[model samples]
Target: MTMTAYLQTMERGDLDSWGTPEDIGSETVEGAPECAGSFDLGSPDDPVFGGLYSVTKGKYRVTYGFHEHATLLDGEVALTNEATGETVVYGPGDSWIIAKGTPVLWDIRSDVARKSYLAVTTDIPA
Candidate 1:
């Protein structure tokens, strides 16, 4: 089946719940190759703050995070290291790729939404 068909099937199925403050939306960028649907965590600060995401269409990446969140399961994240200036790609079922003191860039090849488990830095003990 094509990617679109796979996405359609995913929409029909019930994915495992990630966290709270569930909010969902989709966006289609102008001059972009594909459309994207996302479920967002309700945290106002930082990326992946207490939420889960799934990419229904294309590829995506995260650029910055003021804080870090722990991962409960395997997930995909594309990151560029600020210290080495290198880019790395994580595959499905990978967990907690991003943590504190990490700066990176995200490149999304397609429209993608990821289920994320995020915890703010303040909440995490030093």
Candidate 2:
């Protein structure tokens, strides 16, 4: 298959809702948080995918099932790597990478937080 290379501008704003926190394997630990995303590159059958994700103010816990590199587009957040017990505060323009199986505790410190991400997975649904 011929895949065209493209550039996408990720804006920090409303996006299509993927679902509640549970839909994306996250458990809400505090205040209600709305989650949304836009998968702009690759399919679920592909090994790589890229997209924008956003969540409202709250605290949540989630485990990464795939490797991902992400950049914060807007807002502020404190991410705690549960396994390492290390925490990092991120704001607009911050970036990081998360390996598969890494558990994270997300503390949304702003009204909302938005990020653009590229993820890789070995398993593809049939």
Candidate 3:
């Protein structure tokens, strides 16, 4: 789907249909003193081919490296895009349509918490 279409779908909450349980990776950045997690969306063969994430506790600043589906179900956060130098704040019920190939930095101003649905890309075996 096109980017605009994806954004519109997310805004309308249609993207929720694409969510399912996923395995998330977490780590605490030194000095940041926060815990974070990333869910891995299986493959296209899966029923829900996307990642769902949640910050059960703590606060942190995140750097966005790749384009993926993200939603702010609760709490608050600030995101800065290095390419455009644009910063945006997200709170409950807010969502972000991150463009592909863009780099972003996130500052979890508040006790950072969120849930996201991300599309997974697959690799073909040689």
Candidate 4:
């Protein structure tokens, strides 16, 4: 038997994970929202970035054509629906899912905001 594939740093007190930097390109909202933690390079089966992501502070808009699952690890973010003008504030120990093709505004709160996420694209409904 072999015991391998372990993220020891991920088990630390801090939510921040090391390595795995991703490029959001010009899609970043503001304050250079970055993955301050674990970011995967991806593989064949799961060919998408997944891990702890964080943003210092700021607000930005995005049109999500795919589903996104996020669990707030620290700080807070206010998600406002662009279409319906609806908004929800999420904090630590909180989580949410954004529907596909939905327009959203991300309002980052706190000095440094962080979260663990798994985002992917799918044509099917959740």
Per TM-score, the best of the predicted structures is 2
lDDT: which is higher, 3 or 4?
4
Q: Would you list the C-alpha lDDT of every candidate in the order shown?
A: 0.42, 0.84, 0.49, 0.65
Query: Which residue runs of candidate 4 sit more than 4 Å off their true CA positions?
Result: 1-37, 40-49
C-alpha TM-scores of all predictions = 0.43, 0.85, 0.53, 0.67
Q: After superposition, how far is residue 110 of candidate 4 from its true place, in Å?
A: 0.5
Ranking by lDDT: 2, 4, 3, 1
User: Which window of ten consecutive residues has the lowest lDDT sum in model 3?
Assistant: 17-26
**Candidates 1 and 4 compared by TM-score, better number:** 4
Candidate 1 lDDT over 31-115, as tens digits, reads 2323222334546444334544444333323333346543322334455676678876665444554555565544443344353
lDDT of 4 by residue, 37-112 (tens): 5654342146355666676677667787557787886788898998999999988878898877888888888876
Clash totals, every prediction: 16, 0, 1, 0
lDDT of 2: 0.84
In model 3, how many backbone clashes occur? 1
Could you list the CA RMSD of all candidates, in the order they appear?
Answer: 9.7, 4.3, 8.7, 5.3
Cα lDDT for residue 101, model 2?
83
